[model samples]
Structures are given as C-alpha cells and as structure tokens.
Target: MIPTPAFVVDEPLLTLFAGRFEAALERHWPNSILSYSFKTNALPWLISHLRNRGVWAEVVSDHEYELALALGYPPERIVYNGPVKGRERLRAALAAGSMVNLDAKREVEWAAELGREQPDAGLAVGLRVNWDLEARVPGESATGAAGSRFGFNVENGELDAAIARLRTGGVRLAGLHMHRNSRSQSVDVYRASASLAAELIVERGLELDWVDIGGGFFGSLDDSPTFDDYVGAIRECLVGAVDPARTRLIVEPGGSLTAVPIEFHASVVDVKWVGDNRIVVTDTSRTDLDPLFRRRRPFAVDLTTASSATVPTQIVSGFTCMEDDRLLTLEDERELRVGDRLVFRNVGAYTMSYQSTFIELPPAVYVRDAAGAYTRVRERASVSDYLRGNSWLSPES
Candidate 1:
C-alpha cells in the first residue's frame, strides 16, 4: 500500500480527459496544436503519456529543454518558451530544429547571432509579442501594470525593431506568441491579442509558421469556459488574419488542462481544541499543496470515526510549527478522529511541482493506471534524501 500524503494521478482519467480536451480543440480549430506546458507537471510519466498522444513540449528552461530531448521528444516538436534565454541553450535548440520564440529584445539580438551562425539553415524563428489589450480583470491591478516582463512590447516600436533586426540579420520571422498571466479571464483578451498581432504583421511585413497563445485557460470547470470555448475564441481572432491551412496555431496548456484530473490526500495525525475552536492536524502541509489556502478550490474532508455529534469545531492544520500552518477552518464542527484521510482535489497543478522538504520529506508517488493497475512511480524520500548534496555532511558526521 502507498504511504500517507499521497499525490495520486488517475492515469485512466488522465488519458480520457486529454483525449476529450484535444478533440474539443480540434473540433474548433483543426489546424491547432496543444503543446504541453512542461513547467506545470513535468513528471516523466506524464510527459511520456502526453507526448505519445502527440503533444509538443512547451518548455521554458534549459533543464526542461534538455529533459525533453532526453525523453526522446523530436526536437522539432518542442517549443522553447520563457524570457530568460541562455546563449548555449538557444544555440542547442536552434541547432536541434526546435521552434524558438524570442521573448525579450536582448533575445532578439541573440536570435540575430544564431541566424548569422547558421545562415544557410534559413533559420525560421518566432517572436513573442507582449501587448496591453487592457482587458480588465477583477481584483487585478492592470492600471499601472507594466504588463508581464516576458516578450517584446507591441505598444512601443520594440516588436518592430526586433523584427527588423531579425530580418536584416537574414532570419525569417515565422510566428507570433503572446501569453498573458493567469488573471486573463476573457476570450476577448485573446481576440485583442490576435488582432494586434495580425496588425503588426501587416504593418511590419512579416510571415509565419505558428502562433502560440500560451496556456492558462480555466479547463474542466462546470460553469466556466471549455476547451472549445478557448479555441473558438482564438479561431475567431485568427480566421482571416492567418491561413489556418498553412500556418499552425500552437497552444500551451497548464493547470487548466491538467489540474482537476488529479487529487492529493493527507491523513490526520492529531486532533485538538481551544474552547469552541477545533484544530485537526494532518500529516500534510501547505508545502504539499501550496495553493490550498490561496484559492477557494473545493476539497473533500473525511473524518474517519464512528458516527458521533460530540466532535469539536474544526480548524484543520499541518504538522508545521508555524502558526500559519492551519490549512482551513470549517464553519461547522464535525466529529473528526486521528488517522482519517483528508483528500484535496484540484491540486494536481503545482503541488508536486513546488514540493520541498520543509518539515517532513514525502514518499514515493502512487499511480493508478488507465488499466486499473497500481504502481509506484518513485521511492519515498528518507531524511538523508535532503542531505545528498550538502557539503556539511561527512562520513564522520
């Protein structure tokens, strides 16, 4: 059996959802492609599963780029993203025939150099456009928002200058990319971005291969938008502006596509009360699921105990010594007992991506496959697991 605080992926559910999501997008925009966001859930198994289904790797780091290569991903199927572009990494990606999106103007300079080096390669590249659609989001301060630091500014002549630099350097500007922060809540944001991108292409005399509307859509929400809704919105913007038959539209999806399918479970280890307030300590902490309290995502609570009405008011907490370790508070008190499992859903996004040994190190993750087979993907970490790289540890110590 798997140990406590399990991060489980229903692999069967994953395949089903992925197929459904892909079909949803294809139905709307047949020319579109879904590039899996590696930064979101780069689990090798997860990557392999998606890659086998024909999803491209949308990576933002040198390490992730290398991982994609190591995992047998055809370099051509990888989209190199992110604002920080290391020279060697850029050269490697360019050499490997991966599609590279130049984020900042400095990277525009780098792209020019790469173009000069591989002048005969006829290096076709993409430019990530940073635009201010002024799409309003509640509780977000876009007023003074300088906009995200990634990509070239379209408002100023930065985008034009980058294009000129690349063209003069003999590199073909093949595509446009723009991904807003998660605060972008409307498809209108995409319409505006596409509209502006198309306008710039005409004004600057540019040509392309694919336009990547980076991922952050609210996927699988009952009342929210669906994959079709997002792709439809994108198609509306790109229909006449670009040739769907010739140019590909690449979409990188993250939490929206991958979050809801997986769930995390932490077991209760202690129970206590301070007057009318109840504190239920669990083996898990925010470290396991960082977004637990940050967002109002729904979770299931199981108080493993015989039916009783004498339970204390609930204040679920972690084992951490900090006072802020409280996970959540219940409006009504329930009979809770130690050893009960507390399951948190919609935590599949970054919980594992951001996990660290804050207090107690976690164990190997368990997976229930699509065929209903259970397997251990990783071994549980011991105390020394955290000290493997520490120089302070010695044979004597």
Candidate 2:
C-alpha cells in the first residue's frame, strides 16, 4: 500500500491536458510554440515526459537551463528567461541558438559584448518588455502600482535604451517578450499584453521572427478562460501587426498545465480535543500543501474511508511543531478518524517545486498509469539522502 504523506500523479490527466494545450494552439495559431515553464514544477520525469511530447522547456535560471539540457532538450528548443541568468550560461545559450530574452541590465551588457566578440555569428536575442498592466486592466495586476520587477520598464526609457544598446552593438533582436503576472488571469490580460506588443512593434518598426505573449492564463478550469480564449485574444491583437506566416507566437505555461493532474495524500494519525477545539493531526504538513503559506482557504480535498458521522468543526493540523502548521478546518463534513486518507487536489503547481525539507523530508511521489496501477517515481527521502552533499566531522574529531 502507498504510504500516507505521498503524492500521486494522474498520468492520463496530464497527457490529456498536454494534448488540449497543443490542440488549442494549433486551432487558434498554428505557427506557435508551447514551452513548459520549468520553475513551476521541474520534476525530471515530468520534464522528460513533456520534452518527449514536443514541448519546449522555458527555464528561468541557469540550473533549470542545464536541467533542460540534461533532460535532452536541444539548445534551440529551450527558452532562457529571467532577470538573474548567469553571464556564461547566457552567452552559451545565445551562441548555441537558444532563445535568450534580455531582462536585466547585466544581460544587455553581456549580449552587447557577445555581439562585438562574434560579429559574424548573427547573435539574435529578444528583449523582455515591462509595461503597466494596471493601465490596461485596472486592479488586475498582482502588484498594482509598483509594477513587476522583471523585464525592462517600457514606460520609462529603459526598454528603448536596451534596444538602442543592442542595435549599436550590431546585434539584431529576433523577437519581443511581453510576459506579465496578473491577479485575475483573465483573457483581457493577454489581450492587453498582446496589444502592447503590437503597438510597440508598429511604433518601433521591428521586424520580429517571433512574438511571445507570455503565460498567466487560466487552464482547464470551469468558467475560467480556456487556452482557445487566450490564444484567440492574443491573435486578434497581433494579427494586424505581425503576420502569422512570418512571426511565430510563443507561450510559456507553468501552473496552467501542471495544477490539476497531481494530488497529495496524507493519512490522519491522531485526534485530540483541546479546550473547545478538536484537533486532528496528520503526517502531512503545510510545507507540502502550500510552501509559501499563501492559501487562506482549505485545499480541495477528498476523504477516503472516513467515518459517516458529521463534525461541526475539526482542525486539520500537520505534524510540524509550528503552531501555525494547521492546514485547514473541516466544517460539517465526515468525521476524520485515524487511518483516514485525505487527498488534496489541484496542488500540482509550485508545491513540489518549492518544497523544502524541514522537520520531515520530502515525501515519495508516484505516477498512476491508465490501468490505475501506481509506480513510485521518487522514494521517500531519508536522513542519509538529506546528508548526501554535506560534509560531517569524524567521530575522532
């Protein structure tokens, strides 16, 4: 039997979502590339599977870039993006024909240096444009007025300055990247972003090889904007500016692709009453469910082999010593008893990628096949596993 505090991935569901995304892109914009965001969930198995399925890797760090390469993602197929990409790796990616988007000032300097060093190499790079999302969609941005810390601010002269630097350095920009984070994840977000890209391309008279709209769209959710909705909105905005025949559209999806197919299963270990509150302790911790501790609501959970009796209120707490480790409170639901398994759903994104070892190590993860058979992908970590890279003093010392 699979132990509690383990994760199970629904392989069929993942495959379905992948196919749906590809089809949506094909339907709305045939000349488009779908790159899976690696920072969202960089499980090697998951990345390799997506790589095999013709999905490119969109990485934000040098480690993720190398991970993609290690997993057989060709340099050209990988999208290198982020504000703090190492200079050596950036140069390597650019030389190897990867799509490197210049975000920070240091990156522009590196790009310029490479352009001067290899003047005949045709160093093509993309510029990440930062704009005010609040102007287009009020109150839709996560950081309303402060704006995102990523990309070059276009409202100011930073973006123009970066462009001029690249042009003077004899480097040709291949495309423009306009990826923004939004609070609403609405279709209007993509529409506004694409419109900005279109306006910039027209105003600057840029002949681009590709136009990346970036990724923050809602995926596979009821009453939420679908992939078709997002792609259609973007295409509408860019159709007049860039020809679909020459300029390829690109999207980097992270949570939208991985959120629904995985679940976290934890078993109830003990139940106790303190004063007027009933506390049920489990093997899982908040570190497993919400590593950022951002969720104010309870996780979407399913109880297995639970008692039929209803409870007015019971606090579902984690095994950690931290008092705030309480996950959620069950209200008027089936009474949870010892050995009852609680499966948390829609937790595929950021949970595993951002998880850290604290009181307990990371749990094992299994992938469920179409036949409903579970195969362990990652074993439960042990002390020895955690101590793999650390140096210890000898007993004699």
Model 2, 197-266: lDDT tens digits are 9999999999998898787767775656888888888999999999998899999999999988999999
The regions of model 2 sitting more than 4 angstroms off are: 392-397
TM-score of each: 0.91, 0.97
lDDT of each: 0.76, 0.89
- Which residue pairs in candidate 2 have backbone atoms (N, alpha carbon, C) closer than 3 angstroms, thus clashing? none
Worst 10 residues of 2 by lDDT: 388-397
Candidate 2 local accuracy as lDDT? 0.89
Highest lDDT scorer: 2
Point out where model 1 deviates above 4 Å: 135-144, 291-293, 296-305, 310-312, 370-373, 390-397
